[model samples]
Target: MNKRLQLFSEWLQEQHISLAFITSSPNVFYLSGFYCDPHERLLALLVFPDEEPALICPQMETARARQAGWTYEIIDYGDADNPWQLLERHMRAKNIKLDRIAVEKSHLSLERYEQLQACFQARSWLNAEEKLRQLRMIKEEKEIAILRQAAELADFAVEVGVNAIAEGKTELDIIAEIEYEMKKKGVREMSFATMVLAGENTANPHGVPGLTTIRKGDFVLFDLGVIVDGYCSDITRTVIFKSATEEQKLIYDTVLRAQLAAIEACKPGVEIGSVDRAARSIIEQAGYGPYFTHRVGHGLGIELHEYPSMNAANAMPLERGMTFTIEPGIYVPSVGGVRIEDDVFITDNGAGILTKYPKELIIVS
Candidate 1:
C-alpha cells in the first residue's frame, strides 16, 4: 500500500469513518502516484479504514496506472458500462458497509452525490478536504527534487520570453516563442495559461494576452509556469521594452522591495499571514496600497493553488518543506504594472528561492 494511503486510513480509523472517496485529480495523483485527466470520465479512489484501497478509472488507463506505480485493485469500466454499478458490486464483494463515510465535499458533484445515495445508505457525510490538504502540504525529498526541476524550467521559459521581446511584437507572439521553446525542451504541459501582458494590459493584473503590441515605454510582463513529473512552478517577471519612465521605475522598485521583504519573512514558525503583511506594508507605505491588490502569494505544488493561502487573514504558521510563491505587484491604470514573483521553500532558518532569474528591472532594448 502507498504510505500516504496508509496514513489516511489510520486517520479514518481514528475518526471512526468507514471510508473515504477521493475524486479530485490532484489528490488522486498525490495518493496513487498516477496522474490522469479523465475529463468528463469518472476517476476515483475508494479507501477504507481497515481494508485495502481500490482505484477506479477508465478501462483504457488501467495499464498506465500500473506503470505509474498502482499495485492494488483497479476497477476500470468501459464507455458503455455503468461505473456506478461496477462500484456497487465492488463494495458488495468486499462486504463494505457504508456507515459514516468521508468524501471530498468540495469536489463531489450533486449528480455523483445522488448516485452514491442509490448505492448505500450512509448515516453521515464527513469532509476529507482538510486532511487531504494536511497530507499534501508538506513536501518529501523526492517531491522537492521534482519541484526544483520544474522551477528551473520555468526560469528558462521566462528567459526565452525576455529574449524574444521587441518593440512591435504582439503579446501572443512572445507567448508562442516561449511555448515553442518549452516544447523543444521536453515540457509536456504548462501549469496554467501562459500570460504575456504588455503595456496597459499589465495594469489589469489577470489580463488576457492577445494582439496587444509592445511599445517603447511599455512594461511587458511574463507570468507562466511549467510542470515536471507532476509537480508545478509559477513565476512572473516584468521588463521594459526600450526604457522606463521615472514613475515606472519607482513602481518596479517598490514592488521588488516588497517582494524581497516578503521572501525574507519566509521562516519556519512564522505566521503565514505575516509574509503577506511584510510585502503589503512596504507597498502601502510607498503610497501604492490601493494599486497593490491581491494576496502576496499562494501555495504551489501538484496544482497551481494549494493549501495555506498567503493572505493577511490567514494565521497559519510556516513550516519546513512548505513551498509557495511570493508575488507582489503595483498596477496604476494610467501607467502600467510591475510584478516580481519567486517560488520559495521554507528552510530550517530562512527561505530557499527556487526561481532564480534576475528580478532587477531589465531593459529589453
Candidate 2:
C-alpha cells in the first residue's frame, strides 16, 4: 500500500474501525486519487479492514478512475439499473462483513444511508466523521508540497488584486481582475468565491462584492484563494485605497500584531486552542474583542476547511506537518474592517509561514 493508505489503515486500526465507507468528494479524492464528477449519480470509496482500497464508481467514470493510477480494485457499476448490486457484489467478494460500518454522517444523505443499510445487512452502522477528519489533520509531505504550491499561486493572485485596488474601481471589477490573474497564472479555479469588500462593506465577514465603487481612505479587504493541483490556499489582506486613517491604522496594526502573535505561538505539541487564544487575546486587549467574531483560523489541505480547527473550543494538539491559516480581523460597523491572514505549516522547530505575500498594510492610490 502507498504511504497515505498505510497511514489511513493505521489510523483505522487505532480507531478500532473494521471498515469505513468514504462518501464525501474530498475524502474519496484523497484516498482513491479519483476526482468524481459532481454530476455522477453515486460514487463511493471503501476501505476494508486489511485489504487494498476499492472504488465503487459508475461505468462512465471507470476511465477517469483508471487514470488516477491507483493500485487498487475498481468496482465499476453500470449506469442502467441495479447499480447498488455492484457495491453488494464487491463487498461480498472482499468478505467485508462488519457489524459497525463507518460512514460520513455529514455528507451521506439519510436516504442513501438507508439504501446502503438495506443492501448490506450489517450488524451495525456508525458515524465515523471524526475518525476520517483525524486522519486528514496531520498532512504528509506530499500534501504539504501541494499546499505550498497553492499558497504560492494565491500570493500571486493577491498581488494582482492589491494592484487593482484603486479609487473609482468597483469591487466587482477588482474581483474580476483577481480571477483573471489566477487563470493567467495557471490556477484552474478558485477554492471559494473571491471576496472583495470596500469601506463599510468590509465589516461583513462574508460580504459580497457589489457595484460599490472603491473610494480613497476606505479599507479594502481581499479574501481569496485558488485551487492548484487539487489542494487549496486561503488568504486575506486588508489595504487602504489611499492614506490610512488613525482608526484604520490602529485596527490594521492590531490585527497584524495579533496574527503575528498567533503565528509565533504555533509549534508542534501545542494545543490548537492556544494558537487561537494567543491571537484572540491580542484583539481583546486592543478592545476589539467582539469585533473579531470568527475563529482564529482553520485547517487547510485538500479541502479549504478541514480538521484541527484553531478555535477557542477545540483542544486538538498541533503536530508537525499540520497546516492551517492564522487570520485575525477587526470589523468596525459604518467604517471598515481589517484582516491579515497567512497560511502556516507546523514544524518540529516552529511554524513556517507558507504564504510569502507582504502582510504589512498596503496603502494604494
Candidate 3:
C-alpha cells in the first residue's frame, strides 16, 4: 500500500470512521498515484479503517490503475452495471459494516450523495476535505521535483506566447501557436483554458481568448499553465504589441512592483494575509485599489488552486515546502491591464521562485 494511503487509513481509525470515499481527481491521484478525469463517470477510492482499501472505477480503467501503482483491490463496473450495488457487494464480502463514513462533501455531488445515503442505513457522513487538505499542503521532495519542471515549462510557455505576439494577429491565433508548440514539446494537457486577452479585453481578469486582433500599442496578456507528471503550473505575463503609452507604462510598472513585493514577502512565519497586503498596498498607493480586483495569489501544485489562499482575510502562516503562485494585477477599463505572475515555493530561507521569466517590460512588434 502507498504510504499516503497508509496514513489515511490510520487517520480513519483515529476518527472511528468506517470508510473514506475520495472522488476528486486530485485527491484520488494523491492517494493512488493514478490520475484521470472521469467527466460524468463514477470513480472513487474507498479506504476502510481496518480492512484494505478498494478503487471502484470503470472496467476499462482497472488495468491502468494497477499499472499506476494501485495494488489494492479494484472493483471494475460496466456501464450497464450499478456501481453502488457493486461497491456494496465488495464491502459485504469483506464483512465491513458501513457506519460512520467519511466523504469529500466539497467534491461529492448532492445527487451522488443522495444515492450513497440510500444505500446506507444509520450512517453518519463526516467531512474529509480538511484532512485531505492538510495531507497535501506540505510538498514532499518527489512532488517538488515535479513542480520545479512544471514551472520551467510554464516559463517556456510564456516565452512562446510573447514571441508569437505581432500586428494583425488574433488572440486565438496566439493561443493556438502557444498550445501547438507546447504540445510538440510533449505537453499532453494544459492546467486550465489558455487565455490570450488583447487590448481592452485584457482589462477583464478572466476574459476568454477570441478573434480580437492584436494592434500596435495594445496590451496583450498571456495567462496559461501545463500539467507535468500530474503536477500543474500557472503563470501570467503582459506585454505591449508595439510601444507602450505613458499611461500603459505606469499601469504595467505598478503591477510588476506589487507582484515583486508580494513574492519578496513570501517567507516562513509570515501570515498569508501579509503577503496579499504587500501587493494590495502597492496597488492602492498607486491609486489603483478599486481596479485591482481579486486575491493576490493562490496555492498551486497538483491542482491550479489548492489550499492556503493568499487573500486579505486568510491568516494562515507560511510554512516550508508550501507551493503557490504570486500573481498581482491592475486592470483599468478602456485603458488596459497588466499582470505578472510566478510560481514560488516556501523554503526555510525564503521564497524559492520556480518560474524565472524576465519581469522587465517587453515590447513586441
Candidate 4:
C-alpha cells in the first residue's frame, strides 16, 4: 500500500471505523496512483483499518490500475454486472465485515450513500473529508517535482496565449490556439477550463471565454493550468492588447504588488488569514478594496481547488510542503481587471515560487 493509503488506514483504525469508501477521483488517484474519472459511473476504493485495501472500478480500468502499481485486490465489474452487487460479493468472499463505515461526505452523492447503507446495513457513517484534505495538503518531494513540471507547462501556455493575441482575434480563438499548442506539447489535460477574457470581459473574475473580439488598449487576461503526472498547476496573467492606459497600468501594478506581498507572506508557521489580509490591505490602500472580490489564493494540487483556502477567515498556519496559488486581482466594473497569479509552495526557508513566467506588465501591439 502507498504511504497515503497507510496513513488513511491508520486514521481509520484510530477512529474505530471498520470500512471506508473513497469515491472522489482525486482522492482515489492520490491514494492509489492510478487515475480514473468514472464520471457518473461508480468508482470506489474500499479501505480497512488493518487489512489491505481493495479497489472497485470498471473492468476497463483494471489494466491501467495494475500498471500504476496497484498490487492489492481489484474488484472490477463489466457493464452487465451491477457494480454494487459485485462489491457485496467480493467483500463476502474476502470475509470483509462492516459494522460502521467512513466516507467522503463531500464527494459521495446521496444516492450512492443510500446504496452503501443498504448494501452494508452500516450502523453509522463518519466524514473523512477533512482528514483526506489534511493528508493531501502536504506535498511529497515526488509530487513537488511533478508540480514544478506542470508549472513550467502552465507558464509556457501563458506565453502561447499572449503570442496568439491580436487585434481582431476573439477570446475563443486565442483559447483554441493555446489549447492546441498544449496538445502538441503533450499536455494530457488542462487543470480547469482555460480562461481568456478580453477588454471589459476581464472585469468579471470568472468570465467565460467567448466570441468577444480583442482591441488595441484592451486588457486581456489568461488564467489557465495543465495537469502533469496527475498533479496540477494554476496561473493567471493579464497583458495589454497594444498599449495600456494610465489607469489600467495603475490597476495592474497594484495587483502585482499585492500578489508579491502575498507570496512573500507564505512562510512556514504564518497564519493563512494574515497572508490574505496582507494582499487585501494593499488593494484596499489603493482604494480598490471593493473591486477585489475574491480571496488571495487557494490550495492547489491533485485538484484545481483543494484544502487550506487562503481567505480572511481561515486561521490555519502554513506548513512546509504545502502548495497553493497566490493570486490577487482588482476588477472594476466598466473598466478592465488586472490579476497576477503564481504557483508557490511553502518551504523551510520561506515561499518557493514554482511558476517563473514574467509578472511585469507586458504590452503587445
Candidate 5:
C-alpha cells in the first residue's frame, strides 16, 4: 500500500473501524487520486481493512476515474438507479460484514445518511469526519511546494491590485483588474471572491466589491487569493487610495503589529489557539479588541479553509509542516478598516512567511 493508504489503515485500526466511506472531494482526491466532477450524483471512495480499494461512481465519470492514476475496483451506476445498492453488493463480495462503518458526517446530507443506514444495516455507524482532516493537517513536501506556488501567485495579484487602485475607479473595476492579472499570470481560479472595499466599506471584513467609486484619502482593503495546482493562498492588505489620515495610520499600525506578533509566535509544539491569542492580545491592549472581530486565520491547502484553525477555541497543537495564515484586522464602524495577512509555514525552528508583500502602509495617489 502507498504511504497515505498505509497511514489511513493504521488510523482505522486504532479507531477499531474496519470500513470507511470517504465522500468529500478533498478526501476522495487524497485517497483515490481522483477528482470528482461537481454534480448532483454522489461518488464514494471506500477503503476496507484488508482489501485493495474500490470506488462507487456514476457511469458518466467512469472514464475520468480510470485516468486518475490509481487502480481500483470500479462500480459505476447510471442515473435513475440507486448507488447504495451497488455499495451493499460490493460489501457482500468482500465477505466483509462490517460491525462498525465510518462515514463523513459533515459532508453527508441527512437524506443520504438515512439511505446509507437503511442499506448497510451495520451494527454501528460512526462519524469519522476528523479522520481525513487529521491526515491532511500535516503537510507533505509536495503539498507545501504547491502552496508556495499559490502564495507567489497571490502576491503577484496583490501587486496588480495595488497598481489598479486610483481615484475615480470603481471598486468592481479594481477587482476585475486584479482577477485579470491573476489569470494572466496562470492562476486558473480564485480560492474566494476578490474583496475590494473602499472608504467606509472597509469596516466590513467581507464587504463585496460594488459600483462605489474610489475616492481620495480613502482606505482600500484588498483581500484576495489565487488557486494554483489545486492549492490555495489567501492574503489581505490595506492601502490608502491617495494619502492616509491620522486615525487610518494608527489603526493600520495596530493591525500590523498584531499580525507581526502572531506570526512571530507561530512555531512547532505550540497550541494553535496561542497564535490567535498572541495577536488578539496586542489588539486588545491597543483598545481595538472588539474591532478585531474574526479569528486570527485558517489553514490553507486543497481547500481554502482546512484543519488546525487559528482560533482561540481550537486546541490542536501546531506541528511542523503545518501551513496556515496569520491575518489580524481592525474594523471601525464609520472609519476604514486595516488588515495585514500572511501565509506561514510552521518549521522545526520556527514559522516561515510564504507571502512577500510588504506590510508597511502603502500610500497610493
Candidate 6:
C-alpha cells in the first residue's frame, strides 16, 4: 500500500472502521495517485484495514489510473454495469464484516447512501470526511514544492492581468489575456473561474466578470489562481486605474494593513481564530467591518478550498505545514472595494507566503 493509503488504513484499524468508501475526487487522489473527474460517473477508493485498497473508476480511465501510479485492483465499470452491484460483489469476495462502514458525509448524495445501504447493510455508518480532512490538512514537503510552483504561476498570471489593464478595456478582455498567458505557460486548469472586476463591479464580493469597461480612477480587482501538478494557488490584488482618490487610498491601505496583520499572526501554536481576529480588528476599527462579508480566508490544497477554514469562530490552533489564505477586504458600494490576498503556509516560527504579487496599491496608467 502507498504511504497515504497505509496511514488511512491504520486509522481505520484504530477506529475499528470496517471499510472506508471515499468518493470525493480530492480524497481519492490524495490517497491514491490517480486523479480523475468522472463527471456523473461512479468513482471511489475503497480502503480496508486488513486488505488491499481498490480503486473504482470508469473503464475508460483504467489506463490513466495505472499511469498515475495506482497498482492495486481497479474495478472499472462500463456504462451498462451497475456499479453498486459490482462494489457489493467485490466486498463480499473479501469475506470481511461490514459492521461499521465509513462514507464521506459531505460528498455522498442521498441516492448513493441508499445504494450503499442496499449493498452491505452495515450495522452503522461513520463519517469519513473528518478523518480525510485531518489527513489532508497538513502539506507534505513534495506537496509544498508543487504549491510553490503553482503560486509562482499565479503571480505571473496576475502580472499578466495587471499589464493587460487599460482604460476602456473590459473586464473580460483582461481575463482573456491572463488566461491566454497561463495557457502559454502550460497550465491546464485554474483553481476557480478567473475574476476580474472593475469600477463599481469590484464593490460586489465574488463579482462576475463581464463587459464592464475599466475607466480612470477606478479600482480594478484581479482575483485568480493557477493549478500546477494538481495543486492550487489563489491570489487577489486590487489596483487603481490611473489615479486614486484619498478615500480609495484609505480603504486600500486599511485592507493591506489588515491582511498583513493576519499573515503576521500566523505562527505555530497560535489559535487559528486569532489570525482572523487580527485582521478583522483592523477592518472593524476602520469602520468597514460590515463591508467585509466573507470569512477571512480558507484552506488551500489539491482542492481550491479544502480543510480548516480561517474564521473568527474556529478555535483550531495554527500548526506547522498547514496552508491557507489570509485575505481581508473592504467593499463599499460607492467607494468600490479593495482586497489584498496571499497564499500563506504556516512554518515552525512564522508563516511562508506563497503568492508574491506586490501588495502595495498600484497606479496603472
lDDT by residue for model 6 (31-81), tens: 998889999999999999998999999999999999999889999999999
Q: Per-candidate TM vs. native?
A: 0.99, 0.95, 0.98, 0.98, 0.96, 0.99
For model 2, residues 200-258, the per-residue Cα lDDT tens digits are 99999989899999988998898988887788999998888888889998999999999
What lDDT is obtained when candidate 3 is compared to the true structure? 0.90
lDDT of each: 0.93, 0.85, 0.90, 0.92, 0.86, 0.93
Clashing pairs in 5: none
lDDT at 328, model 1: 94
lDDT by residue (90-170, candidate 4, tens digit) is 878878678879998878889999999888898889998889999999999988999999999999999999999988999
TM-score between model 5 and native: 0.96
- How would you encode candidate 1's per-residue C-alpha lDDT over 269-362 as one tens digit per residue? 9999999999999999999999988999999999999987999999999999999999999999968898999998988999999999999999
Q: Candidate 1: which stretches are off by over 4 Å?
A: none
- Per-residue alpha-carbon lDDT of candidate 5 for residues 1-365, written as tens digits (9 for 90 to 100): 66787788777778888788888888888777788864889888888777777888899989988887767688899998778888888777778777788889888889988887787777887887777888888889898888888888888888988999888899999999988877777777898998989999999988878999999999998898887766889988899977788989999999999998898888888888988999999999989999988999998888889987899998888899999889999999989899899989999989998889889999996
Candidate 2 achieves a global lDDT of 0.85
Return whichever of 2 and 6 wins on TM-score: 6
Better of 2 and 4 by lDDT: 4
Q: How should the candidates be ordered by lDDT, best one leading?
A: 1, 6, 4, 3, 5, 2
Cα lDDT for residue 219, candidate 3: 95
Model 1, CA-based lDDT: 0.93
lDDT score, candidate 4, position 172: 96
**Residue 138 in candidate 6, Cα distance off native in Å:** 0.7
Give model 4's TM-score versus the native structure.
0.98
* RMSD (Cα, Å) of model 4: 1.1
> Which ten contiguous residues of candidate 6 have the minimum total lDDT?
88-97
Order of candidate numbers by TM-score, starting with the best: 1, 6, 4, 3, 5, 2
